[model samples]
Target: TPVLLPLSAAVNTYAVPANVLAAPFVPFITVPGTFAAVISTTLPWLAVPILWCCGLAAACLGLIGRAAAGFPQATAPWPEGWVGWGLVVLYVFAALVLAWGLVDRFRYWHMVLLAGAAAAMLALVLPVTALAPSRGLDHWRVALCDVGQGDMLVIRTQESAGVVVDAGEDPLLADQCLEKLGLDTVEALVLTHEHSDHYGGTAGVIEDRAPGTVLHAGSADWDVDAEVESVAELPASVPVYRPQAGEVFEFTRELRVRLTVWVAEAHHAEANDNSLVALFEIADPQLPVGQIGAVSHPLRLLAMGDMEEAATASLLRRDGVPPGVHLLKVAHHGAANGGTELLEATRPAAALIGVGQDNSYGHPSAEIIRTLEAVGASVYRTDLHGTVAFSLGPNGLEAMELR
Candidate 1:
């Protein structure tokens, strides 16, 4: 009895769903009888080999199932607050009690206890996973899209309205992301530079709903027809403007969302030098991530186009580099050319990198990431988190992975 008890308990420990243990033991009872019947008939020698092979296969499969079931949660987020911790402790205690109860009562009650343990664990984890609300979307402010090897940022002007900065390389992806956000119309579509990656999705932006205006740097003239040949053309009267340095484009002044553009006048041999830079500030936004009551604080965000060292240095010289910027958009898809000097000058709290997974250019240079970290700035990359987003409100600031 002692040997049987320990053997049964050991088998149960490795069983997934607390039921797979039956598979190995059930064969022991049925196989011997079936083999005996076969031996009594014509195929006596074959019965032994067939039973051996089938039994081995079943035991292997059961062990595999146990290994799979025992895998720890790698992606699940840890829940916050006392309520969360209490729930976790409760689940562990209940599971232990149910497991102990199973030894005394060996009936359908054992299955009930196993199911109860499962329910307890589910109740503890659901709040940290699927049921949890997105921290950024709870008070949506800025969202950087995962457009793959490109940049696409959206700033919420109102509940159903936003301003798009760059359309990224894929038209369909940019369009779908906007659709998912429930924002069809934008205050304006701001193209930082003429690079296809930054403006290639212009067609998608204008295909379904056209922006109030199209803003770009007056570096080079683009052939409108060729650019939007696949989709639709920018409305002839859409009032395309080439914003100059020190130009403040005001939108939602009452709500306190303001934007100012900065351009460099230095002679540029490379196309990237002419990249347009901008500062987006939200005054005393409503933050929801704080432990205390709703607190009001301003947020300063800087968007760097694919501007190289020369252009960035020129920008710093002209504007004198703003200090204590809350967020920075890492320039040139995190290329090595993305100046560490610029990151140092701005001293932003967080750095956002919009690069693809396994990109050919090896974007988001490791050196740049290390520099940002050295500056005590938290770095969030689209490659790691998918679409990274942030929200700053009266309560506090919150960052989330939209995907």
Candidate 2:
């Protein structure tokens, strides 16, 4: 019984939900992460073979006992074969489990660990993976569809997959954008930074559509009743991938966008500058991953995550904006930060600023506009037009202003 107790505990441990441990293995298949693969690659010498050996041993013991019990020379049935059966079942399960750790490898494992992984992953990933894309055969496109004051972005792809970045100032505008894009439930919805303009009409959008995922900046003011612990809880079969700084959760290797957590204070939303800056590598049109040495479009996209001059300046230091192409999302509705040196370094061909019409802030201050213009960057303002969008085309950028 002494030996059996430890063995029983070990076997039971294998069934515990693995969500706590699964983060290390992210981006395994559809989702692009490598902590697990790294461990699997580096730690190849030990566990796999041991579990395999144990499984083989357990099966052999079970077979041997079964064979011996049926022999004519046997006097009574073997009582201990039940133990052999248990071990056999367990080891087989362990070996089979790693293959289908999550939906990425969708095979059945012990019911015990599955539940645990779900609960633990839910608790951990709920907030972090909020904006993270789901993993699947799902190919989607999300447009924060450039609804100027009112945020209205649309997410959709060739597949049935869809998500909305934000519903612009107008509820009718959002519906129009949805209709133009031929979309229903965003499948996933994200409010990058909260200002009434960003979140105001969003509730109207969510009221009708049932999305598979919803992630926001946690910025204040938006009343999110449907928000939950994990994207898994979003009445959808989707697997959401949220991340912290330096954590590379892939939107796609080329299009991958990592969230850099840059908040010193909590509760007070940074609003416009608090925008989620995503480094979407605009890969070379001609080169493949193998041939491409460095991203040609090395420009960092400052989604702002509502990061003001203070936040942007700090992030600039942390990320180190190189002397590359500048694609700036002007901070604080283009409120004056006066970071002239930073603008020169960014060397943006163009810039986009979102400010309200007749707003109180007097945003896009001339000082800031001149600063961006001084560096040879053309500016796009939401207040002047409506929704703004830039697509990476074959040659360069397909820039447009959506009204």
Query: For residues 81-121, could you state the per-residue lDDT of candidate 2 as single tens digits?
Result: 45534544444454456445654655444455655545554
* Cα shift from native, residue 398, model 1 (Å): 2.5
Candidate 2 Cα misplacement greater than 4 A, ranges: 1-164, 182-187, 204-209, 219-243, 252-275, 282-300, 322-326, 337-342
Report the backbone clash tally of model 1: 9
Which one is best on lDDT? Answer: 1
Clashes in model 1: which pairs? Answer: 285-393, 285-394, 286-393, 286-394, 287-393, 287-394, 287-395, 287-396, 295-394
**Worst ten-residue run, lDDT, model 1?**
4-13
Tens-place lDDT per residue, model 1, 112-208, is 7667767876776665545553333545677888898899988877776778999898889898778756677788888887788888887777776
| Top model number, TM-score | 1
Give per-model TM-scores: 0.66, 0.48
Candidate 2 similarity to native, TM-score: 0.48
User: Model 1's lDDT to the true fold?
Assistant: 0.71
